[model samples]
Target: MPDLATFQREMRKAMVAGGVPSTTLEGAVVSDTLPAERRIRVHQNNYRESLCRALMSLFPVARVFVGEQFIKGVFAKYIAREPPCEAVLSHYGAGLPDFLAEFAPVCQVPYLRDIIRLEWAIHSLQLVEEFGNALSADGTPRLSPNVRLVDSDYPILNLWMAGTGQIPPEAVSLKAGGQCALVTLSGGEVRLAALDSAQRQTALRIEAGEPVEGDSLTMLTEMGAVDFHAG
Candidate 1:
């Protein structure tokens, strides 16, 4: 008899891989109405479908761009390659951006990976709690905890906003060049704004725990990207 740990490992592999049950698992699953292999298949399908739904929800923009069947296929492979290790699905697809980067089918749409990266940033903002006051008594600048910086070699913001119908299609051009953005959550809504080179540098410096000054700070402050605190 396989130990409980060994059985769990095999069960996870069987469920995610969606292959014939290993002999050990087949022998272990005692069933009456369905054979052990058939029962395993049922569970496998359910698990795969659930994970597929999770991935779709996490990257809805990606879904709209890639189509349901194609995204599902890519997700199926991702699930097989990187099975969920935790019960919380909110953070489950963190690796998806990198996975898409190397995925051969996605090569034709090179910017797709950057789109996923932006989507993940937006998704992550949902978990950050709102902090009070961007400025403290001492006037040191403190960025909102919900703020995230995403720099892409593609016009990801234009593409994303255009694709979601938030902006006119004519407003976007693939040749319009790369973009940097500050993604933040406010009043329970996610917001994204393009940042210029100087603002991007200031944001990166803030993230790296470095001091920043000058017009960049003013720009970030006006955009509600920072608060003055005495940190």
Candidate 2:
């Protein structure tokens, strides 16, 4: 009889790899009319099913872009290559954007990877349990968590909006160009807003890990940002 540790290791390998030594699970430890390989097959199917469902929830827009058949194919390929490490499914697809980028089949859709990144960000923001105190008394929010506001050239906000169906279908022209965006959480809701020059400067400073005060406001005014309130 294989020890518990060795049995667990072989089971994991088979669960993710679909092929383990048939005798790995052979022993009198457990009763079974079914062979060990057949039992392992059941586990593999369950793993695939759970992983596909998790991916579907995380990347609905990607699923829409690629039909169910294609998505299933991609998911199967990805799962066989990359299995879950953490207990939480939310973190499972963190590398999906990179995976999609190198995937030969989806090379035609260049924007698909970026869209996946946006979806991942949205998922992460939703999962974050604590946020910095950045709102004003009037209910307007401020960007207070370092300088994440001014980071990234990807127009991530628009990309996220487009992916999640928050933007109008007709308005979603991929070639329409990028825009500066402000991302914030308020009253348990995530909000995205366009940023003007001043806000952008302030956001830059915040992102650069600089101190904010009167001087930041002056720079923001020069950039045509009259509103410093968070969105």
Candidate 3:
């Protein structure tokens, strides 16, 4: 007989992926309300439902972009492939951006992946506690714990905002070129700012290479996108 830990692991896998395992359940748990398999299914359904809701909360824009039925299908595959490793639901969808990037069915919306990234950043910032100084010894600034930057070849910010119904769709033009976004949360207010050409270039270079040019770094410092303190 499998050890208790091994058996439990296998049982969980079975519950998530299929009907309870064919392996004998000599001492398997039984629910008074239903057979063990049926009871396990109820738990499985609830688990998936919870995760699905979390995903929706994090990526409302993506959900709108893809439509309800399509998002449900995506969530089904997402649940099967990327079971939560963390207990925190807010942290659960960190990989979703990459997952959507590679998911072939979503290719129609090539910018969808970046949209997910933006939403994930928002979701994560709400849960992540701030720490450390936002400034360094060289008078340069570091990124705030709640601050994030992303660049994509699409107007992801406008799309996300419009999808959420926060702004009029007419205000955003899909034909307009790429965008860089600076996301920050301050005093419980979350804001997404569009970056200018220089700022966007600086942000891209910052992520890909080292610090940007001095002037751009200074701009970052001025905008408080860079760290402002050592603590």
Task: Name the candidate that leads on lDDT.
Answer: 1
The list of candidate 2 runs beyond 4 A from truth reads: 20-22, 26-34, 134-143, 146-170, 194-231
User: What tens-digit string does per-residue lDDT give for candidate 1 at 1-231?
Assistant: 699999999998799778898999999988788888998898999999999999988888887777889889999999999989999999899999888877899987888888888989998888868765555556656676767778888898998997688989788888988899789787788899999989988887877767889999888877778885635
Q: Report, for all candidates in order, the number of backbone clashes.
A: 6, 4, 9
Spell out the clash pairs found in candidate 3: 132-231, 133-230, 133-231, 134-227, 134-228, 134-229, 135-229, 141-227, 142-227
| Global fold similarity of model 2 (TM-score) | 0.69
Tens digit per residue, CA lDDT, model 3, 1-231: 667887788667875785555455424755576676676677778888888888887788888887888888888788888899879676788887778767899888788888888888877777767654345567434566667897878998888889889889899887898888898777676778898888877766655545555677667766657664433
Error of 2 at 145 (Å): 3.6
**Which candidate should be chosen as best, given TM-score against the real structure?**
1
The local distance difference test score of model 3 is 0.76
- List the candidate 1 regions with Cα displacement exceeding 4 Å: 1-5, 30-34, 134-143, 168-170
**Looking at model 3, which ten-residue stretch has the lowest summed lDDT?**
18-27
lDDT of 2 by residue, 1-231 (tens): 677898888777767877644465645235479775666677778989889999988888877666788888888889888988888888889888778878999877666676676666656667776444444455332344322242334554565666567876566565655545555544556555667555666666655546565655655433333234444
Could you tell which candidate, 2 or 3, scores higher by TM-score?
A: 3
Against the hidden reference, what TM-scores do the models get? 0.86, 0.69, 0.85
Alpha carbon lDDT of residue 227, candidate 1? 80
On TM-score, the stronger of 1 and 3 is 1
